[model samples]
Target chain A: MAEIITVEHPEDPRLGDYTSLTDVELRRRREPAEGLFIAEGEKVVRRALAAGYRMRSMLLTPKWVEVMRDLIEAADAPVYQVDPALAEAVTGYHVHRGALASMQRKPLPDAAAVLAGAQRVAVMESVNDHTNIGAIFRSAAALGMDAVLLSPDCADPLYRRSVKVSMGAVFSVPYARLDPWPASLETLRQAGFQVLALTPSAQAEPIDRVAPHRMPRAALLLGAEGDGLSHRALAAADRLVRIPMAHDVDSLNVGAAAAVAFYAVAHGRPGE
Target chain B: MAEIITVEHPEDPRLGDYTSLTDVELRRRREPAEGLFIAEGEKVVRRALAAGYRMRSMLLTPKWVEVMRDLIEAADAPVYQVDPALAEAVTGYHVHRGALASMQRKPLPDAAAVLAGAQRVAVMESVNDHTNIGAIFRSAAALGMDAVLLSPDCADPLYRRSVKVSMGAVFSVPYARLDPWPASLETLRQAGFQVLALTPSAQAEPIDRVAPHRMPRAALLLGAEGDGLSHRALAAADRLVRIPMAHDVDSLNVGAAAAVAFYAVAHGRPGE
Candidate 1:
């Protein structure tokens, strides 16, 4: 069982990880140990615990501690019980969910390790939006994608907003950032994975045409919303595919497009 | 040609329609005439103008006046050219886009009118998130969905955030509120449309199986994120359809699901 600590002061040094959060930009720039990645709500906290992340501590209102005793008992970290008002004061917002867990982010797995036995994978480049990153993780988890590979410029999937938006699915989906993009993509190709770039260019084949049966191990590459894949990334892909859209319409949001692509690829293969 | 009006005072009554926008709740509750809908940036303003939404007035910096000369020249309403700071002061935010348009709220089209001559439509229930509402419109426009039918509890699609998030697709897509709850759903069935409620229920049929080719006029219904379609709305549907998900995942965001459902139903259909 984890230790139970009662917190009375809002400025407790142990609660340093939860400070300055309203200034999200500064908080994001803070060094990892002090900055801390927070998972809010019972469901997300539980997911963090189950995913083998090293939990620093849990802060919860007394009522929540009683209500979520089972979940609290399962955690190997300490639990801090605070008054709801103190909890709100420390967090700089009204956390109605009453439970939050801070976890040390694990070292990212290597791209090759993530893709070794994977059948379907998503490769994202310059997707800087945290909500979109979280949504893509949720979809990838639900649509049977074996793993996700991110470019260095992508948003942090373990960010607070990403964790909340993903409903904790970010903890379940295995992902790693490729150090040298476009060049790093060669690793997937060398492993016999077909790298398919999704673009709006007319030359790209429709997504349905390149069914899952044709490519057992596939990497679906996506780009940012306004500007698509870089020339280097496009050149690196083995083939280009697009979701056929209505004339005069531009494109779906990156997150929505990821879900559609995951479903298309996963639906084609039954029990991979 | 639009009459160019110069306003020197931030308190000018002419700017009443453009103030107090940071307070979203208050802005949402503002009377249509007192709180005109704001369309920002060049593209959205052009779409609003083309939609015949009765432009009340426009505020633009000198740069926008020159950059958007063609669109401004095409409008029949007054255009106020203000300095960037003055525009920001009147609008309560940094008007970085330099162009904003306010339009009178036209009466919503009749539900039947929106449905008439439509082969594909999305029926929404209790989808209160403005961003989700906007994203659904964007997807509907991109996937060739002919109309969007909303329940009484749905958020206003013309809200500033919705308009911005939809990338002005809300101006292009037709929508109307459906009163009388599930009873209003019968109108679609009466018109020989198949009403398919999107849910994660085990009994629901997979969405791909009910493709657009199989149904003449299909209405894909969606609900709020946490709580799916209300029992009444589900009961009203002719059938229940689900986007197949992988193990342990509950569902996707309503907006993402709408895109996938729209694509599954609208793909390869003639004239779509």
Candidate 2:
């Protein structure tokens, strides 16, 4: 059972993980360094726990205490009950959605390990926008993509905004970072995966024509929003593919593109 | 020729349409009432004009004036010159993207008119989130979906954030409101459309099975993010369809779903 404690001070040392939740820069540096991530709102907290993430501690207003009573009892960790004002002061925003939990972060799986059993994978390069990262992961998970490979420059999928936007999908989809950048393309290729780069250039074949799902193993390469795949990354791929667009619209945003691409890549996979 | 006037005063009456733009509720009420909608940044402003929207006026910082010099000369509308600081004072946020245009919102075409010529259309019901609205438009336009129809309760497509998020694709796709809720769905049926409602219910047929592209005319019915289509709307649709997601994921956010659905609908259409 959780140890329930009443903490009135906003500056309470034990509540350190929950402070300045809105400061992107601080949290980005602090959370990973501290081996913790903050999951806010009731549904997200519930999803986090369901995904097997252990609660380091939880901060709740009095009203949310009862709402999270079962969670508190199940966690066997500290549950600090603060007034609404104190919760707001500590979090730098209203705790409108109820309790916040600081969950223990698991060590990321190695890139090779993530790639080993994967058939269809998405490899992102410099996709630093957290919401896009989250949105892509949600689509990836939903569409039956096996794993995700992120370049070092990609944003943390565990970021609070990413976690919220993804509806907790960040916890479900297994992902690992690929260091040494474009050279990691060799890692996928060596694993019997045909790596294809997604781009809007006319030189690229239409995605349907590419028929990625037919490949025994395939990995898709995507880039950031405005400047799509870099020259080096594009050069690393076995093939270049484009979504056949109507009219002369330049391109879809990365998030939308990812969903469409994930569906296309997963749609024709063998077996029912 | 365009007339350029330097206005240093933040309270100038002519800048009224551009004031307090960050205020959502006020702008939402005032823009439609005043027969104007705000488009921020150079690309969106250019798109609005290219889409044949008449500009009542434009406010620009010094740096962007030269960039948009050709457009200003062609428009023959009032162009107010303001320093970045004065621009911030009037708009209640830093004008980082260089310009804001007060565009005349053309009278929306009748639902019948938009449906009459469209072969593949997306009809949205109660999709009140502005970003989702914009993202759907972006996907619809890019994927060759000919037009869009919005239910009465759906959010405005030309809202600033929607305009920005769509990257100005909102201007390219033709859309109109379908009033009287589910009853207006008859308009699509009358236009020879096989109206397909997108839902998460297991009873709904897989979207690929629907093969809307094979139909002479088709319109996809989408709903709000979580609650999904209303019973009456679902009952009215010719058939209910769903994207076959995996890993027991319940549903996709409407924006992502729209992209996947739009692609699925537009994929096997006639032509190259």
The DockQ leader among the candidates is: 2
Candidate 1 Cα misplacement greater than 4 A, ranges: A8-11, A29-36, A74-76, A83-92, A269-272, B31-36, B83-89, B268-272
DockQ of model 1 vs. true complex? 0.45
> Which sections of candidate 2 miss by over 4 Å?
A269-272, B269-272
Q: List the residue pairs that clash in candidate 2.
A: none
Q: Judging by TM-score against the true structure, name the best candidate.
A: 2
Q: Give the per-residue lDDT digits (tens) of candidate 1, residues B1-272.
A: 88888888889888877887677888888945464698888888888877877888898989888888887677788888889888878778898898988888788898999988999999999998989999999989987899999999999899988999998888888999989887989889888899999998989988766665368899999989889999988988889998888878758888778888888877643322
| Per-residue lDDT of model 2, residues B1-272, tens digit only | 67999998999999998999989999889998889999999889988998999999999999999999998899788999999999999999999998999999889999988877789999999988898899899888899999999999999999999988888888999999988988989999899999999998889998877776678888999999889999999999999998889956646778889998998888762232
lDDT of 2 by residue, A61-175 (tens): 8999899888887888899999999999999998888689999999999888998888999999999999899889888888888999999999999999999888888888889
Give the worst 10-residue stretch by lDDT in candidate 1 chain A. A263-272
